[model samples]
Target chain A: MNGIGAAMRDAAEGVDVRAGFTGDVLRGGRRRQVRRRNGIALALAAVVGVLGFGAGMAMRDVPPVSDERLLAATKGDLADDREVLLTATVAWRAELTPSWTRDRGVTELRGEPHVYWASTTPVGDAAVVMQEGKVREQWRTLVGLVARDPADGFPKVVGTTNPEDPTAGTESFQFGPGDRTFLVVDPGIPVYASPNATRNPAGVVRRTWHEVPVVDGVGVWTAPDGVAPSTVRLVTSIGPPISDIPAERLLTTRPASAYLRSGVHAKRNGAPAYDTRMWNNTSRKQLRVGPDGPAPSPDSDLFQALEDAHMTDIGPPGNTGTWCVYGTSGTGGGLLVGEYADGDEPSTLFALLFRADGTLDRVQRGPAVDFGSPLPVRVRLPDGQGWVVASSQYLGIAYRTSDPGDWQEAQTGSQAALLPDAAVQVRVGSGTGEVVVDLPR
Target chain B: MAVHAAEEDFEEFVVLRSQSLLRTAFLLCGGDRGAAEDLLQEVLERMFVRWRRIKGPPEPYARAALANASANRWRRRSRKPEADWELAGTPSVCGHEEQVVDQDAVLRALAELPPKMRAVLVLRYFDDLTELQTAAALGCGVGTVKSQTSRGLARMRELVVEVTR
Candidate 1:
């Protein structure tokens, strides 16, 4: 033990001292060159989009939704049959290739199409889409649907009715015309309207996105009085307890390809859903799901499970590692979801899996789910073969080995229905776990 | 005046942190010279445009950018399993000849730690940063730094014990 500690210390010290000089020298020189290139590029873009600078600056102050409003929106009730359309011209850096200067386009909502949607209140299966208009770069001539099941907070690509080829070579999300339908059953924070503008220290016109810290209250919807609409006004002066105070928060404004290449949207059921072939960043390696496997499909239950969650996890993926896997049942019903986590580590992934549900049936270490954060964390699964999750959040693929480990004394109900097509064999660090599902292959 | 103006320029910040940033990269890459170099380049390019105001210290920003980039790489690689890696050697055991131990194991253990824990450990052990410095680098209180460091070290030790045994 003593020798071990000393060795560890020596290793750490050696790493520290060696990394210091080498990392600096190598990193400094290479980074300087890259930064220089980028600096020149940004300077050129600024010159070209000079007109955009002021408007872009003007758009900056568009108020953000408050926490109270977020909470209130969560609690808003729409009758079982009520649904309404939510539309907004979101302005962010396009998450697509060539990274548009900035996005200033309208996204519209109607109840999940093909479903009888009533009021605009957001609910479990509600769907909204960004309509076709001129984006800064390639034109999206038709309506493009980005559907979300707030119930699970997973989002899927419904379809691109728009003409111009917008996002290709990107990790495309498929939402069948009706496959990704959502029901907006509740009222959310009314769209916030900007109050006024302020001048900058440079005497340039500037505005900040501010929201009033008021409790639940609905402001009149003015933009589309002709259409069913909802809108509200918020001020940032009220401060705390009433609303989410405005602070500089990082809103992702990168191109969609950049985001996709990061694999932030990859992985499910603890198994690698997408293959590295999908990775656009040739400089970096794509996350290995299970050995050479088929690509993800629109019919994929893994994709379905992700769509169930709005495509946004509770927190950043770096915080909690998600454990997932596909499993089969004797009755032919398959399970999609397993234990899910919000932290970015293997233990957190395992802890979330074994949290009394036994839904994460396997005891074997599963493949690592690397959330884009500091350091890659291996998402581990419990040992066992053919583990199934009742929910998609816990789906993970363990390395190959199908022995059912000791079953804990826990709730056993109608075993989870598994999807057959999704059942797969996954390997991790030389170990294998069998993912048995009932979905058709 | 040029210095002040340059300080405000995003490019200058990237240049300033390049070396330290690379060092951070080297630590995260488990001393894999090639991967570390590649990771450093990717981050530097990312910080190139936004060099002006990445908010926190350039080092932390760089570290974070590297971490996120690496994590993304792993996520994609895990899904595809296509990156070809030559076997450096056999897995190293604890108390075994120093030459035989797996450097990847130590790295894997470190990588397995929570992002925060791993970050704290890297700052402390790899970078040899003091507790206060680590806290400052991460934008947290000293307590968080201390607790995270202790947990990370313990986790690393556990991995070592499990593998060596």
Candidate 2:
């Protein structure tokens, strides 16, 4: 057996092979199935309730209910009906989508529409109006009606209106003219017209519209052309968007200055760099880098040198860089090398030679390499020593030392060298600078 | 009656194969017996739900579910640590006594690898599945399995050397 396979087999030898399970697996399984079935059933029931409530609101008239009355009705006697409100709000929002009225010849509106009011009339008719933001990229006022569903519980969009135009201010077919209860929602904040607003096929023009804040929150209702004044009703309440936090703030929390680096320090240092490689030949008990250099142990002072050279912490999110370590055979110490770069900034390379005594031998920062050409940087060090090459253009490459046949191919990004005694070499493209260190055995 | 018969057959399969399946789970959970039991029970419950529809043997599906669940849990629990790449403090060499190659030391080393890599090792070694079978179980291509095996074994070797040194 191979060394790894044999080692793993030996390790698993003492693990308890007996399955001493006392819990009832069958009962547990059956209980889980029951829970799943219950969840699906509950979801379907809620959908039906919402649909029934919407249909009732459209067909009948409820007593003129104030905001407090509506909230109290929905909350029932529960102390915490916030979850119910949120769920109902989500279902109402789902019904505001364009597809909700796609078959009715209404296009789905862009931007999230907040549902401010949803209630059933005393006689069981359902009525809801969703305040949508600017339409067609124009800062024009648009409101959508959540019409009663023809079949399923999903709300259909019976119609939408441009509130600014008296000729197009209201859609009358869905709701009959009567003494119906009205829930007036005026988002006191100013609304702007979209700069690129275009007219829809329904002949509603997108015009710039904004509302001046009124003290009583009441506004005059401009009935659609030919509608009787007695049938038109107006109510007013200042209801801001549900949450105070901006949508953009919730989506991205990255700091503005996180990637800020001083312009003066960002320039690349023109230096010759080389693509380098390293490997340990298990049969020969020798560590080799390129054609001759030996692999370094982890306790060497090279770590200190890299730190002194200011080339540490050069991996990932902050910079496109990679740091990798491979265990050396015979010695318990590891071989560590890292390379990192910021765009247009000088790339730095660091390497450390570690001994069994916990002391590190740091490699001095080598001469800078000229950019543009793929320069070759080679270091011939004695056994138990190492080096690093860095450049602005160091093409991040990784090599597998465990498989001899796989050494020719390179893996992108930085990778760990896992084989302690496999012959391997890595070719690193040097674009900025290279550092080399040789520790005395 | 037919449904009852199917449930009985499923129960029989669990009774006969639970020991071997638990061994695979134990290794996958880094040798934690409790976590292994929980993972095994969850896998069995899911398998029981679709027992009738499952064609062929159920072992592969169970193993695949175990791997996916372990990986998802690891992702959810671990926040990205700061990108500090430097090895902190002095690097200690393992004591020479550990060079004797203890089984516990090897298992501990195996436990330290990432979940996907560990799963690959357990599936390939403990389950004794081939590259093709491992790929099918993991819902990935054979090339991914090959690369993961190579990388996993390499990392395992490194840990072993550190422990044994």
Candidate 3:
């Protein structure tokens, strides 16, 4: 025939689909799901069973820490590195004085600490140990991380799951300042590593989310060399995401500054042109960077194009920002994504398509980012080349420096980069704290 | 998510995409519809088990898993070896329409190749995936995909010519 494609299509279409095929697939899938859920449950039970046995024996002989303290500490992702005999420090007093004792106005860390989930990290022995402490009079939980001081090799408390408040809402403790880091979350929280800041409304940004896999009550991640700690967000259902795991210190090794700031300005005839659209403030409100490439757009220019491409509903005026054309060789043109400076003011992010002759082809704009919302503003480039990533600040992407590759600056106002399919570790971020995260294969 | 919602999503995905995936499986198996249905079911079931944990849409993961699983299956069954077409014999193509004859002969040619080579062709040409997408689906290098597509087409041409003779 016509070609192998046509032949294959003809042959496949001719293959009759059996009745109840979808039902069969669903039933089989449900069976497999039940089996797996049972598997995780069984695995958790086994670990807890052994722990309970150990605690029982310990209670009968000496009772190092109370049964309540022991059980409380052992909760959350019950995976153990390896069962080890607890080398309980003699006597219940402070080994080196936990720093939290002297400062708090209300509750102090009381009762002896119990080292529960101790495992060898990429660095040294790290543990998700706990000690009983009262907060404001209520016996609240205090979670802490134990790791070698890295400075002198002395095992010290690096960080703790922070709620220290009357109530705990998915608190997290991330250990870092090295090549690899460990993290622990208080079970019920759904966590993702995301970009730092996205400008709102007039200059919105598309934030990214890569699920943080928690093992043994710790988030398993390693910041590649020469990068900063990735921002982690606790995605809540109804509202904006709670930005957790602040970029204080993590294996990313060094701290990066938030250098994203630019108002809607573009290059026109070798000079600057600004998006004098709704709530235009890029002129006085930009940080150090922002909507700087493709100047202000004609709304109707991007309207029909965006609709035809099934990108966005580009009606009258809502979102306004600068747009640029990149990857000219691709059909129609490259991705048209825009972002804003890291300011909370009402700014919008827009994506535009244009011809080589500076003619407008398509336009897309929206609320940009709903921080607490799970919806992602996405644009799949034509012909499966790649997609776009937008944020408030400039971004540089590359395979890990720890592995091999240099950071390439993302496209101008698009604030986006098209990651090639072969990359392993793509480092995408800027002053908003660069995170060298794994590109899930 | 609650158990019911997860089930709903898994069911939705299966009903929506299983037909298309079944067709892909059919081509990968050299037009064995029964084998294709079974292969698709196995992959969909596996995806169901991981429905909640899978972020975004499950199509990408499903395709990749299908390609990889299909290769593994062929590898496992290859130890015993299946009967091959008799290269020395030529069946008559006279009565059948030219298009029908070509379709049957090309499918037979596909069945003659190694499973991975067959999978590479199906993903690249039939599925209309880019070289990179094909490579990713099969967890192989783009170089491997390129070479496999070339060799598969050449071998199919030879087989089709011999069969028509």
Off by over 4 Å in 1: A1-441, B1-23, B52-61, B68-105, B111-116, B130-147
Better of 2 and 3 by lDDT: 3
How many collisions between residues are there in candidate 3?
23
lDDT scores in order: 0.35, 0.43, 0.50
Tens-place lDDT per residue, model 1, B1-165, is 222243235444544655566556554554444566677766665564455556766666677567666656656665543223332112223344653454545655554555567667766665667888777666789999888777767787897666556
How far does residue A61 in candidate 2 sit from its true spot (Å)?
Answer: 40
How many angstroms is residue A246 displaced in model 2 relative to the true structure, after the best TM-score fit? 80
DockQ of 1: 0.02
Model 1: native contacts recovered, as a fraction:
0.00
Is 1 or 2 the stronger prediction by DockQ?
2
Off-target runs (Cα >4 Å) in candidate 3 are A53-441, B82-96
TM-score of each: 0.26, 0.32, 0.35
Candidate 2 off by > 4 Å? A1-6, A14-22, A47-441, B79-101
Model 3 local distance difference test score = 0.50
- Candidate DockQ scores, in order: 0.02, 0.14, 0.22
Q: At residue A143, give the lDDT of candidate 2.
A: 45
Ranking by TM-score: 3, 2, 1
Q: What TM-score should be assigned to candidate 1?
A: 0.26
lDDT of 1 by residue, A332-368 (tens): 2322222233222232222122222323222222333
Per DockQ, the best of the predicted structures is: 3
Instruction: Output the better candidate (2/3) by TM-score.
Output: 3
